[model samples]
Target: MIFLIYGTDKDKSHEFLERLMARFLKGKNFFSLHRLDEESFSESVFNGLLKTDSLFLNKNLVVAKRLFQNFAAADYILSNLEILGSSGNVFVFWEEKIKDDFLKKIKKYAEVKKFDSAARPDFKKKKEDEELFKVADLVALRKKQEAWFLYQRIIMKGGPCEEVFWKILWQMKVLGLIKRGGGRKLHPFVLAKAKRAAGLFQEKELDGFLGELVQIYHDYRNGTADLAVGLERFILRV
Candidate 1:
């Protein structure tokens, strides 16, 4: 059997591949499983493996990761799709993305699946993010103690620091713009929040805080600071 799994949602796609392996392993005759990730990947190696047979096993499983990153290797695999798909050996491809044209051609021989991270966010995730947005609102309200406590609690619960930082930055920017009378076109709920948040800070204070955020980002990129640490400090200082 041949499987083609590629997607922008890497974690989800990876979990799907793991499920495939588990499902295939449920049978008694399944022998060995081989994986080719980018670090150990080569077209020649893959081709040789495909031609080799297991001495004592009914079938071997081959999993290829990120092969599409190498154009020549990807083309070689696609060109031999029929042989690979029809062989007794099981083949699987896991990629983050692939050319649309090549995908069309490979669809004839492989069972293809895609999970697009760029698509609309999942509803459950949206609700969780809404909770974080309220945290951002607390920051805008200058409720420092409450925001800091919630931030730590959320991080402890596995919320992403980068997401939290960006959310707060976005809310602050919106509030700053509304304070300057640019929020007339915003949604009623959004405008109301912006206006209320804007009242908590002077224009100069907002600008200074934004600059501090920029510096924090620069420090992280230069390896002098960690994002989570910097974000915590930012919330505490605010």
Candidate 2:
């Protein structure tokens, strides 16, 4: 059996992989597992699936994460799906996202599962907190828009105040709109604008904003950050 698991939630994705690992570990004598990631893909990728004990006892587990950085690797894997299937290989794959056409071809030989970022467990919770985050995010987004308008206004009017610029910057910081630059540098306003457009400022309030931002930057960078419904209550309380 072949499995294709691709999703934005890395935590849950790893959890699912762990569960699968547990199943194989139970009958240790029945299975032999091989795992690969981007670093090791080039070395052992073309070797295909390796046989375990014997046909009846040959349960194979192949797990790959972030295996394809370019179309070359993806094409290589796609081309070999049939060969793996013919060998009765059980493959498990995980990626952030895969192209529709690639997924279609993999589905023909594997039990394909698409795990969307929105479907992760406890992903949607605390309506009040979510609403608060949304408000914060909205305020941050507006400040960004306002900053652009102000920049244009300054250029047209031929002078802008340090105070006005600082005010916009402060607003962005408080609303968790700005991204800190490497070392002590500040992120460019334009870069901040792009990030806001990409829905990166979904966490609004002070506490939630910091927590979510850290979680996003580190733990679940691949996942989506949507404003939760509970944010409304938090906004009212604020």
Candidate 3:
């Protein structure tokens, strides 16, 4: 049984992992709980612990953290997801962030949960972002001037930089999906808008733009860049 709790909401994910461990330990006298981390991860140790239980405990739970950021551990996990899934012990992987491709493969082998920090805007964001979706629509209509104006208006009225940034990124993702003709899962109105926006950029351009948007958020989180400034620059560049 493999369980993967990941994404940008580290606090929530960590709390959830602890709650789950508590539930698993309820009414239990002796249980084996093993932990692995980026600096301490070892394939040999992980494998040994997975198959070996203490004499005093009948069930074992192995909780791993941020191993995906470690190249060796990541590669080992990618190659052994199936084995981990079928193992007798419960395997829990707690990650702050993981690459999309790696996450996709892990989804097939584990009970997965993703907690995004951006899902809830900060109180400083207020309700000014109510019209933020309009920015995406403006882009689809190729009204760069109006898009920039609306974004500026929202930001001036307490709209969060993270919210606006994610909105623009979402627009790019939708456009990219429509460009690739793979937005069958999107809402009809959104799909229509994306079709209009898809013409504004080539596939490679959208990919590059998306990558840069992700980097901007990462840099902002790491305190290396201001999200508002980065978003302003990106919107101007696009």
Candidate 4:
């Protein structure tokens, strides 16, 4: 069986993958396992590996990290997925991010699992925290309309405006650190999400957003601007 493991939680996704491989190899008499990363992988290499006969091994496992990010590799794998299955190799595709349409298509042939960053235990403890992440993620993904809608919902639920504001700021800070070549101390999951989201805005844009947010907070405190309206406008402008 092929396993397509992806999403924001890189550490857990890799842990799960290792556990799966261990489970598969536990009682095996002979097993063949291979690993490849994006830089070391290509359609030709994968095809040759698939077609090669493993006479001594009863099971085969090929772990590829971010292989689908390459168009040729993705196309080859999608087209020949059934062939891979028939060849008796358990292929694992691990990625931090992937195209939504490709993920949907792979579900038919692969056991797909997504480990969302917001679904962690800490965020699960408070419903509002989960909602806050939704807003933060939407903004990071540049889904401004959805971010504004979720922000409004959080406000209606009496969630602290400052809490949401700080979370967004924190998310931006993480992204800024990534863009500026820092954040080595962050959790693997947080680092991965920040790297993925950093593409949405340039360093100058992030700095501008933070400055605007500071002014908005000042205006709110002085009673010159409605916090909710100011925040909503900020989300749209991002």
Which candidate ranks first by lDDT, i.e. highest?
A: 1
User: Please, what are the lDDT tens digits per residue for candidate 1 over residues 92-188?
Assistant: 8888888889899889999999987654568967876876887898899888899988888877866656678888898878877877779788899
The order by descending lDDT is: 1, 4, 3, 2
For every model shown, the clashing-pair count is: 0, 12, 0, 0
Per-residue lDDT of candidate 3, residues 1-238 (tens digit) = 8899997765466568878888776785355777777898888898887776555557678888788889999999899889888877888888877898998999998999888766546654445555777876776556778888888887685455666777788888888888887999888887777887788789999899899999998776543576777877777677
TM-scores, all candidates, are: 0.51, 0.47, 0.49, 0.48
lDDT of each: 0.80, 0.53, 0.78, 0.79
Off by over 4 Å in 2: 43-45, 51-59, 119-184, 187-238
For candidate 4, lDDT tens digit of each residue in 186-227? 999988888899987899999888889889877754435766
Best by TM-score: 1
Instruction: Give me the displacement of residue 202 in model 2, in angstroms.
Output: 34
RMSD for each of the candidates: 10.2, 14.1, 12.7, 16.3
| True-structure RMSD for candidate 3 | 12.7
lDDT of 4 at 26: 77
Residue pair clashes in candidate 1:
none
For candidate 1, the TM-score is 0.51
- Model 2 has a clash total of 12
